[model samples]
Target: MKAKTQRLYLVLGALVALGGAGALAFSTLGDKATYFYAPSDLAGKAAPVEAIRLGGMVEKGSLVKTGETVRFVVTDNVETRQVTYTGILPDLFREGQGVIAEGHIDPASGVFTAETVLAKHDEKYMPPEVAGAMRKVEGKVS
Candidate 1:
């Protein structure tokens, strides 16, 4: 091969190698990706074993306390979703506020077993999870 052709082959080979490495990394981390969704999305489109983020307003008068476990409903304009969490809730977490949850969906019962919950901090500042929750609460896009 000519000198330039050899260099081009080397660069192409390097690019291919890098592309393969990126694909592997993405595949490994894909399941780890957490997506935030509205109550409607949870109730409607999510499939089993699919990791997602559930966000919405914590339903007022729906927060139930049982020892360390807390149960509440998240609502979107289109639907409402029930969640049972066995852990301490955030101080910012309250009825009628935005909240987002990360976990996989259980198609059988149609409930999400959240590994972590995201609660909003303020009117302007919102963490990823918190943002999802806010959108969930907002429901309709405006």
Candidate 2:
């Protein structure tokens, strides 16, 4: 092969290898990647037994507590989702504020069984993943 062609082949081969490696890594992680959805977005699409991140404002006067398990409803104006968490909630967690719960949903009941609950913080503060989620859904809802 000509020297120029040899170098071109080497570059193309490196690019192909890098692309394949990236595809493999992304595929492996895609299953484990958790996507956050607002209560409105979760409706009809949320599958019971499938773990996901649910985010919305805590409905006023709907938070209930029994022992370490806390039950609340998250709302995104258009819909509400019942969430149950068996862990300490953040001090900032309050009704009428944003919250994100992580857990599996009951396919039949549509209730979320949250293993972790994250509360919305200041305007300048929020989990990066959650922030990204909100950004993703921006303009997609009315």
The prediction achieving the highest lDDT against the true structure is 2
lDDT of 2 by residue, 7-47 (tens): 99999999999999999999999978777777767777747
lDDT per residue (tens digit) for residues 39-71 in model 1: 765555646466777777778899889998787
Colliding pairs, model 2:
48-107
What C-alpha lDDT values do all the predictions have? Answer: 0.75, 0.79
Which candidate achieves the best TM-score against the true structure? 2
What value does the lDDT take at residue 92 in candidate 2?
90
lDDT, candidate 1, equals 0.75
Least accurate stretch of 10 residues (summed lDDT) in model 1? 125-134
State each candidate's clash count: 4, 1
Q: What is the Cα root-mean-square deviation between model 1 and the actual structure?
A: 3.4
